[model samples]
Target: MQVIKKLKDFRTLELLQKANELTLKNHSNEITLERAIFLSWWCEKGDCAFCYMSTQKPRISDPKKARRQINSILAEAELCRRMGWNIEFLSGGYGSFSTSEIKSISQDIFKITKQPVWLNIGITNDLEEYGEEISGITGAIEIANPELHDKICPSKSLEDITNMLEVAGDLGFKKAITIILGLGETPDDLEYLFNLINDLKIHRVTFYSLNPHKDTIFETQPQPASLYYAGVVAATRIMFPELEIVCGTWIDNLANIGPLIMSGANGLTKFPLFKMFGTRYGKRVEEEVYWSGRKLKGTFTDFNSLKNGADLGELNPFIKRYIDKCLNKKPLKE
Candidate 1:
């Protein structure tokens, strides 16, 4: 109702100000820098009309090539921990790994980092397999309308996506859903999105403006205007006051983040956190976050420690077992 009234006014500045005020009043002045450990770039059915991954369509999706070494993943998790990040997502794309593999990977990372494992590795059908080990699950609903989503992702269904979130929530995992702007979705579609989040008891809402990859079907589509993107973030903040709202950043849209921060985005995602070895990206990220007058949490700090080498478990026996398993020093326990 507030959002609708504000829309009738249609003044971008006022809308953003109200959202900013609401955010500061409810939540404090803080923004988080997110990190993800990629387990695979390969997607089995990479045919979404607007997907950046679809450009890499493989004739045959080999799971072996689709997966990354667990040792590398463990090291990255340790790096994130060293950087003072409480959580990092483990992504393997769609059909990149099996349930057993995911369970094993999640357990090892949790033991090593002591940070709750967040899974963004596409939709997982068997939430029961991971049980209480995994802390969070993401099932991105890029398109709000069922018909539109079906049209864009012919191989998938809204039911499959919603079921993943619902099951995760029921199983006591923090469930997050992503809504991508500039994917042929209108501002009006936010109403459906709001309703879905409310119904699902979603804990977080992530927003991204589509950054089309070259040679993809959506290559010609323009990204949502910065003002429009900020507007979406503002409306989401207004509607979901208690939810964690994160605005995703790409290199192209990095500078436009200030407007998003002011429009009630409490966090920024994909800040090239793993590239801490280079100060260029890190310097710019801190400067931008400070420019917005919000303190940045989880910025890379352990440059020397990461460069040298960080180990996860050296004391605890249980953690050492998982670490050994990830490092291929011992057989994985059943």
Candidate 2:
């Protein structure tokens, strides 16, 4: 508790550095990757003021098209698994589909990707209905400000979400949640947010800046300033040293990617994977991460020439040698 207060008092650089250090000591230099599958855009309560999904396009209106879409999605999932990407989580408007429909598609995804599926099914007692197929559950109170939550997300309930998390705990499922900052929430609200996380013993959190979408209630609400967002991220890391913290960002915000990495985000969520491998935005993200001296596989970075000055050559060899030394064996044969 004292440590959290001290973190609050830290200046920008100090706070970021402390968070980075804790991450390095507790986690690692490697940034894990995560991706979300949008099952459908048909949110029944499409009035989420801060969201644009409802206003964009329609998915649930055409059952045939939606069913065809799932086949393509399954192909993509298989390819991602082969390309070293983990289909970690699934998200969408569940209000339009029956639980059984979700279960069928979820099982299909798991059968191909061979990874645990973490889903946001929300406020239901039916997690076991999916059996071991859905191994994790998320109850997102994206807006935690009591004053604003009902106004922004009228269909969502804080008490119901609390109940959902408790049930997830009892089922021994991996539990996670998300929080969007800069919704006019106050300092007191932030304190309450962390306390709720502690009380729930959440296994992971995904943090996002309030991204005002077109034609929504907050269409004009400016995105949270990059530095302010980074500070909140750092505070989350400092508060929960070993907790899995995933940050959400878009191509437009790539400039702050380095600061976010240095501030203790262990993974990225909602990133566009389709554009990541061959596009300019993907290259920009790679350089930003490389400049931070963090390693990401498949980027083929040359650590030797990078200004961050973390050596690249022979690092893999050294890892082998370190293991050999532990076994008191001869030098690495390679």
Candidate 3:
């Protein structure tokens, strides 16, 4: 399929406007933004060139430490619920936890709060038998181009990722896939991935702009232009009108939010509290205390206080501006 190649083309702008209208029409008045909690801090696939986790060693195994981490996540989930946000638990490290351990953790969380939980703990072959406590499964296929995937993630294969998605679908799990832009991938590569998504009946898609971490291989690489990112968001909506396209909150600049939403993204994934209080436990391979850190000095005291203090509400003005500009056909003043 022919795709939009240029970010500033007149045709691209028109399509973006159309997508914005479509999003408003389908979603009614409010866009559905979601929040997630990182179950752990590091990645098990420790060799991915673009990830900070790749620079670190795997976490050590300790039942006591694991229990504490689980408790912290549950506490945060409760806080998130009180904030009127349905929280998804993302397993940070790779699939270091065994199937039974994963299943038991999900069961524990669900039994306590009875809320939806999402898992992204890397590929586990026996996931289908891991029980239905999880609401969905997320597989981050960072780049659609096979060559790029192989180069950046030398530890994983595209085929394994595809099979994982297929297995998740076969087992009746809602599939959420992540596609990172500015990974040296072309529009055609995105089209190919979208086609695969359509074929697999994936439930949700989230877009992330490549943010090169300091210690990673791509640290010095320039981030993709905001306009290009916005263009991709618009094109994605045009291609999959009914699919839930999420704008990731990890984006550094708030200005990009307006153009991203205007280009038809209907969901935002954020975790301000998680960033403030969360701890990182790498995969099971090193010392238990090897990868643990946080910003605050005390225990989590108040959910409302933390939520209020966060800049999470910054998206509101951007959304309003995008809507006004769309309706009035006037350029939004930056």
Error of 3 at 268 (Å): 1.1
lDDT measured at residue 182 in model 2 versus the true structure, 0 to 100 = 78
Candidate 2 structure quality by residue, lDDT tens digits, 299-333: 31221211222233433343333223233422222
lDDT at 260, model 1: 91
**Highest lDDT, which number?**
1
lDDT of 3 by residue, 117-232 (tens): 88877776877666658888888788878889889888878788778888988888888888888878876676678777888788788888888888877899887877778778
Prediction 1 global C-alpha lDDT: 0.73
Clashes of each: 0, 0, 4
In candidate 2, which residue ranges exceed 4 Å CA deviation? 1-10, 56-68, 297-334
Ranking by lDDT: 1, 2, 3
Candidate 1 lDDT over 1-334, as tens digits, reads 6675565466667778988888888997878876667888778878788876677665444556657767767766765565555454677668788889888888987777766787887767778888556888987688877778888887767788888888888888998887788888777777888899899988888888888778787888888888888887888888878888888877667787899998898888766554432345555667788898889776544344433334335423433443333333222222
TM-score of each: 0.86, 0.82, 0.75
- Better TM-score candidate (1, 3): 1
Among these predicted structures, which one has the highest TM-score?
1
Q: Is candidate 2 or candidate 3 better by lDDT?
A: 2
